[model samples]
Target chain A: MVAAGPNRIDPYLIPALDGVAYGLLVFVAASGLVFCFGVANILNLAHGMLYAIGGYTAAALLDGGWASLALALAVGVLAAAAAGVLLAGLLTPVATGNHLTQALLTFGVALAGGSLLVAGFGPDDPRVRVPAALDGSVVVAGHRYAAYRLVFIVVAAVISAALYLVVRRTRAGMLVRAAVDDPEMVACMGVSPTRIRAGVLAAAGALAGAAGVLGAPIIGPGTDTADTVLLLSLVVVVLGGLGSMAGTLLAALAIGEIQTLGVALLPSAAPFLLFAAMAAVLAVRARGLATRWRTT
Target chain B: MRNEVIRWGRGGVAALVLVGLVVAPWVVDDYTTAILARTLALALVGVSVALLTGVAGMPTLGQTAPYAAGAYACAVLGSRISDVGVVQVAVAAGAGAALAALTVPLVVHARGVIVLMITLAVGELVVTVLGRWRSVTGGTDGLAGIPAVRPFWGLPVLATDQARYLYTLVVAATLVGAVLLLLRTRAGLLLRAGRDDETRLRASGHRVPLLVSGAHVAAGAIAGAAGSLLVVAQQYISPADFGFDTSALLLLGVVIGGTASVGGALVGAALVIAARDWLFGVLPGHAPLVLGALFVATVYLLPSGVDRARLRPRPTDVPPVHPDRPAVREHAGAAPELRT
Candidate 1:
């Protein structure tokens, strides 16, 4: 892929780094979906609304200053969590319904939530301003990269590591894993599956919200941001295989790379590349890249 | 004599409905006729969804793929061919069916959720391709300047909104009637059985995948025809016309009208179209909030749809039991004893 460049850095390296950052952001957005679908068995189609809310909150509140940016991010995450709780409450009645009903209900919520955002923020594209500290360029391997993007990579990596530890090591994580494997068995063991599910939904909502705030600078929050994020997350979850964390991470990173590289190489065909890759993956593994855990 | 009377009564009702549709545009304003035409197109799509999700028990969000394919086919062919006639619609339907045939392997034999996702992916992919193929699809601007639709057999072209409305109404009603008739056939019964329990259908030696694929193809064709009708009605086609939102709206209409009922699809489509048209006119940007809330309420309160009121279960409406199925018999026998 390298053309002519002895002293100059390979052009692909920047896009690759950009891809890593984008992949990490996707992982953050999709991680919650993986948890909710795996453990709670609820595919929250409205998860993107939470991300949009977070982004909007940040965009509206951030004054481009460092302190305000931090505060805005915090507030945005909290707002997203609240939205999540509201979604969970709304879905509680229909949780027992078939997947189709659940999907429809969540879709309704998404529609309403999206419109509400439009109403509150207006239809104008609102973007979050990067903090002053992360505003300039930084040298990476002799190549200058956006400081905000590098910071994003570090922050997302930290979040991913923490999330991995929590899901793999903690008692709550153990409960989540058990519930995912078999909710009925966990219920029989004395834990209320509904409560666990609600908690997971809330946590997943928070993660989506955080991703929204963090990703707003890179992706830019707009009227259709929720739909775009939702589609990407769906791709990530499906490509990773439903309810598989490792699969989501890997799939997210690969998709992030494909998206960036495709845009760089073939701008016109960029959008289809992610989907074409997904179609190829699904063709090979009909169930996705990874299979779900089977108790039997 | 009784069967003859019942059939005559049904035929009379059908004839009356057709007469009313033909005469509707004359009484109503052009705006109302345009709205009615839009409603008819949407209703066709709703029927397609009901056929797959309601009758066949496969909830799909991929109908937009064929719908867009049909519209794009019309936009491309109609623009090139100078004279757009009924034959163009047929070609559009073929395009839709071809897309459905391509997607059959991905959707058929998959689990319910997986099927939904795969179909959704297909729909998204179609939209993406359309948006990227700038030369043909015109990218985001979409294809415009489609010729006015001409009726078959050297008939006068539908130049006015009223004529288009009448045309859409006739096509939609025919498709609805065809779907209703299809539901009465053995294949329809097999679809319903597959919906209720695919395993049982498979055990009974039916090819469940093939059955599902057939229903999908039929739905795709219907949606394709609807898309062509939409283009005829508006004389414009865009990628945004057949996006995920439209798919969701169609599904919502199917659910609101009552799944598995032909009449329900019509009622649901009307409600959706009216709400979209009127509410957007009245509230502008706030229509989505209202529509969204209405959808959630409908799903929560009217799970079966507005047609539920007319379809109350009668005391004699008992589920049929297969006498040859020993497993079913054993389960039926043990159920009451365990309760007792």
Candidate 2:
């Protein structure tokens, strides 16, 4: 029989680690959304499809033993970035203020991607194991934790820091922010909105791909993973404002904590709790804090 | 004069199409009939989506959820009683209307992408609940063994196949006809105006929100009825029937067939349904790719719906058009343009 008992203290520590890991994952996922929504004003429903593409590419590499784990992941991220560029090219023309068309088009892509994945990989779920080098757990605060999780946390934090720096301190970031605030003004200054949009979308896709490859080990690559990732990313974006990367990160962390806490405190209600939280947040914060923050 | 002739010809063609549709089941095989029935059922749902998306400019991506509500309502009702299709349909419609009423207040104010997201969430919520709530919804396994619909009269109605097809045919035609009539009324004009500019509609001293909510509820009721009819035809109701893909398909069908016209929605449903059956039978593995390509192509080519022109009807009668300049008629006792 499966062991049924109250949660232990050591396991509680695991939840905290899980929360951090998930938070970072959410940050990477929502960062792409920040670029698309903030810079392009496109509610890309296909964002999750890109995430799935990354995961599936990594799975293919790992399955084929074409490279070492790190190399495979790198390849996966690069592949996803390439796919993102292609998607950007196809979508940029149609990504105007027509949100319904954008939503429907991306949804079509997602559905097609999902069905193709299922057709290719079979209906059964696929799992990607941790690399042997990072499989063991390390003792921390009297609790054993997976080393892979720790690595994920550190790497994600570094990436987020780098992304923040790039946005705040770099010229590209200026163009991105300017584009978000006033695309017409940015264009009037002689910068091609198309080029900026392309670059941001590519960057977003790369970030999503990297996150997907990294998350594959924890969440596993599967048919429905794309949908789940998309929903979570959307929830994060909604919690944050339309165009704020900082808000996206903060909301991601909050959502990760909620997920971990829900699983720990109320397992039975956990499934419903996520959506309840989303609805509650949307109802309360409708336009998010950034708009209000700016006004104040 | 030419415009009148064209209008008359178009009306005649529509009547001929209706006659062809009424007799379609008898000529086609059982499989084709079944597919046509399925198409009609989906066409009903598509009409509802058209009303929301086409007329009201609301991208409601969850018609399938309400559709499933109707299916489950009828399934539960039909299982308890004998095959009282009309009563079950009424119950399903009521249930759907109730559900739409509950959600419309919150949803009516949301526009553009937000509306899409919220309706999607609602759809997902319903599907998840239906899948998990085993006691009421029969959970994942779903309700099966629903009795087949019987004829209203006890006459051995052509072994029930043609009869069932005719029943669906009548319902689909009647619903389409009713929608057309409604669209010609003053309320329809108001709806169209509201769709174009709710601000202007409000400025005109009309209660815009109430009108929007009313449209939503009515669309929901129609969608529910369609779902109930679908279940009656299929003899089963599964959570899959109400899934996200169904919502997407319904939306796509509306877009492809042309959104604002009931005839367009019906044609779209027929095309999608027929194409799916044909493609699945022939190239089963390539269906998604084909469907995806179709969506992309349709969006690219027909950015405006296919029947956008037909959506607005022309004035039936017209004044005489003479190319030659007419002699000016003078007022009262003046000469009749003798100077010209």
Candidate 3:
């Protein structure tokens, strides 16, 4: 986008606009990661496959109508949520073990599940049918922008606001948070921590599924979709510094801009930007969280 | 009496393996020999993964970064600078060590999953660069037609499968022996101490971070040498050779090999790599499903696991406020052990 003063349209505006939607999409996907890894302390590596479950559901079911969208949303969320429950069950054996054990289990599930999905869905990148009303691009400040992409803005905001309320206001969220902080106390208070774990996984899956359906038109469903989503969500989790809502939102926004506007500004350096940002952010975070064992 | 049998069993296995390596080319088909050579290179990389994960307590998913660096360095060097195997390996190791030294600060302080994540990021960064650096890395199509390498300046170029396999075998065995010897020294003891309890190691006035940095560079060099071997064996190099799938398999192989044992790492890595390669060839699309199921099954049935000290859920080890864990805030002692 060349610098245009008065008469010409500013090209940065479109990417900047797209950046908001992309950031919101990332926020929606990453919240589930924060819930599982951040709140529950479960390193669920298959979170992306769960999101892909929803993406595939959207691609297979949606036919560009409101009712189809609803049906797809319901089926996608339920299927992904069911997968989450299955993952929770699978995790039971190695749940108390170190992160590597959990990683082995989760990554196994992801690889197997992802392969089965490809086999079932056919080895092709299926297209998502956006709702008929939002199928075409809308003119925004002289630039035509895909209307389907804009849906992430309001949906993500509502989801984040609702998530904030639940974690802050609801009794269930309190138990979940308390379970993470002190499981012994939660057990003493007559709650099964296992149930909380399953619930958290299911909730995380739902969030990922919702994002999958909503963002499918943008990210799409393919063999590599699960991996890409997983990595991006991980980056968001790391850059967000883990477990903080405000931090996660800001980090998602920063990543979204770097991916969109940053790419526009420096096309040649596009591929390196995300990982570079991730490496730098993670390195700085490590220094700050330098082990308490240093002087213990 | 039990000790005698166990020791004899280990010795017998070692002797059998040595014999097998020596006569592998004579018994196996050319195709199998090529696969075995590739697996040998990967097994060497697996040794490096073990050096970090088993000995240093830093689980990684990014050693592929250095592996790729070494492979590309060897490819470039073999084409432009030298086609000598030893020289390529040395250059590749240097490239890997240099890369590791640069990224040491990013990974040195962290422990547990954070280290895994950071290393994974590092690997991904290298991959992205390889896929995009069109003029140099050939932009995902990868650098093909790499020249054949001579094992040494005076030796003939390895033109046959048997010769290539033998060269790879000799190099891998030498590197593995060196790593095993290194682990027996004081440097290895200090790394193990740091892994067990960084606080205690620090209190004793040990430079824990420096030890980690050294280990990181050493592993990088080892992985880099493996890269040169890969080029010599395959005569082609690609980003896919050092991808996440390879890294994951190698890491898991090291775990299955018994993280603390170099010989175990070589065997474990060879087994997993061989299984994956064989499965891919035989089952085609069904490889991942079968492998995934096996990993999950291994986690449950073999609960004593790869790192027995780490995987076995001991109440005494994971204290409520254990600081060694990456995320110290979580209540790790929540889950009840299915077995005592």
Fnat for each predicted structure, in order: 0.40, 0.10, 0.59
TM-score of each: 0.89, 0.86, 0.92
Q: Residue A67 error for model 1, in Å? A: 1.7
Best by DockQ: 3
lDDT of 2 by residue, B139-255 (tens): 999999877765453534323566677777776676667776776677776776666556666777998778879888988888888887787667778898787767777777776
Give the winner by lDDT.
3
Local distance difference test values of all predictions, in order? 0.76, 0.71, 0.81
DockQ of each: 0.36, 0.20, 0.49
Regions more than 4 Å wrong, model 1:
A1-9, A95-97, A287-296, B1-21, B82-84, B304-340
Task: Please give the ranking of all candidate structures by lDDT, highest first, separated by commas.
Answer: 3, 1, 2
Worst 10 residues of 1 chain A by lDDT: A287-296
Worst 10 residues of 3 chain A by lDDT: A287-296
Docking class of 1: acceptable
Task: Residues B229-316, candidate 3: write the lDDT tens digits.
Answer: 9988898887888777788888877776666667776777888899889999999988888888877877777565453324211122
Which residue pairs come into collision in candidate 1? none
